[model samples]
Target: MPAKQRSFAQTLNAVAWSFIGLRRRRDFDEDVGALNPFYVIAGGVLGCALFIALLLGAVRLAVA
Candidate 1:
């Protein structure tokens, strides 16, 4: 989400940054215009799934 459409990796990186709950205003502005909405949505879903899986795994270990 620079001056051009972001690639898959770039999209994921952006998604990751968002997940962390902090973003630079300059980057946010760039992403708002240049990042694909679909890719962002898909990346968010994938990230959430992975986070849930890791959380469940940790809980299982702790319980065991």
Candidate 2:
């Protein structure tokens, strides 16, 4: 069967779960076929940026 395409939000959700290393085995299996490469890469980069920004914000808050 052909893989089903995912929406942007679904892509980001998958990326977020991946970043934290918290996906269920079954879900990961399903996502393996469903996630778009372009969306995955974009979401990964965006997630990384947001994570860095949050860390910086927290550090600034602590310092201030």
Instruction: Name the top lDDT candidate.
Output: 2
The superposed Cα distance between candidate 2 and the true structure at residue 17, in angstroms, equals 1.2
Residue-level lDDT of model 1, residues 1-64, one tens digit each, is 2478898789999999999978788899888878898999999999999999999999999999
lDDT minimum window of 10 residues, candidate 1: 1-10
TM-scores across all candidates?
A: 0.90, 0.91
**Model 1: CA > 4 A from native:** none
lDDT of 1 at 3: 71
lDDT per residue (tens digit) for residues 1-64 in model 2: 9779899999999889889999889988998989899999999999999999999999999999
Error of 2 at 37 (Å): 0.3
Instruction: Return the TM-score for candidate 1, rounded to 2 decimals.
Output: 0.90
What local distance difference test score does each model get? 0.90, 0.93
The Cα RMSD in angstroms, rounded to one decimal, for candidate 1 relative to the true structure is 2.2
